[model samples]
Target: MEDKRAAVTALPALFADLVRCETRLYNALNDRLREQHGLTTAQYEILRYLHDHPEARVADLATEFAAGVGAISKGIDRMENLGWVERRPNPTDRRSSLLALSHNGSDLFDAAQKTFTTRLTELLADLPALTTVARTLAHLRTTLEDRRIGLPAG
Candidate 1:
């Protein structure tokens, strides 16, 4: 038991390292996006979502992003005011409306996407074993999301 504990001494700190990495990456991306396109990373992601999933509702975005509906609605309001996205009556529901990107939004997304990709690429260029890390993180994300803890040993 003593040897096992010693062997895994670094395991406890892995979560901290993961969080630090996420924070650094997010800040870097956000800064780059804002400087280059006058958009925050979150705003860019919302535009990206609208670009890909046209006619989606606020609830759909909230669920897709794991955010609150009110927060998503507020974000939509801001984007609508910016002329980046627009809402039309939801054909399927009276209480809800569908969202789509405006022409300007599409154009901005394309330009910002290039900056985002370039910055992300530059940041990740020094990282090793990208594929392995990505796969492991994906599995861990799914495991955590499914709440698969404290299960049967088998």
Candidate 2:
């Protein structure tokens, strides 16, 4: 027997609270990286991808990031300007360029990887309901991926 007016007020608050919670987590993680290594979340993502795929091209990175070529190019330009990445001509395509982590980039990525893994483990260790939370998130991710691929859940 809740009043519709009361329920309407609560809905917006609940949605806003969820958004704020997500933003807070992203900011906290970003601040940790900024403090420890002066790297942004986006930069870290690109570096990690390049490290894994070594010599990945701009087109591939663009597709993987789901960003436009200009956005990926801008990120690469910034990373390259900082000596964290390098781009060489693609052997098969004159118009495309391949990106790879430079020595400095690899060193930085290795350090950040350890730091992120350690901190995340520590964070999870202190949580009482982490197992349930992780399972729920995994299930949600799988559901979303399946939907994206046009597969019906049985």
Candidate 3:
């Protein structure tokens, strides 16, 4: 009972530590991505997603990013202007359009993916329990998705 109480009391601090770690990692990655590829972390994420799931709609990206539809639309607009993405008329929905990576986008994503992977590997290689930590995080992410509990749309 005492151990249970102590563990429960420690939850908030543990959660905060998790958030801190995530923020630091994201910041570092974002800086490297911006410098090496002229891409923001968010932009890279969108491109990466589209590469894996071509012809996705704005709503799909919004849901994946846990962001607002309007925000995703604005980002898509910017990417389109930069020739990183292209929008085609959605066959089933006249009001919506399908998004896919442009040639430039594909090239950029390929390079960015390599850089991202290398940087991530370098960062984690020194961590002795990296595999265990990764598994734990994956389980947490799956549980969150299963419970439909996500970060609020930005």
lDDT top scorer: 3
Off by over 4 Å in 1: 1-12, 146-154
lDDT of 1 by residue, 120-153 (tens): 9999977899989999999997886588453333
Distance from true location, Cα of 123 in model 3, Å: 1.1
Q: Rate the local accuracy (lDDT) of all candidates.
A: 0.88, 0.81, 0.92
Q: Candidate 3, residues 31-136: lDDT per residue as tens digits?
A: 9999999998899999999999999999999878777899999999999999999999999999999999999999999999998888888777899988899999
TM-scores for all predictions: 0.85, 0.71, 0.93
Query: Which pairs of residues have clashing backbones in candidate 3?
Result: none
Clashes of 3: 0
lDDT of candidate 2 at residue 66, scale 0 to 100: 57
How would the candidate models be sorted by TM-score, starting from the highest? 3, 1, 2
Model 2, global lDDT? 0.81
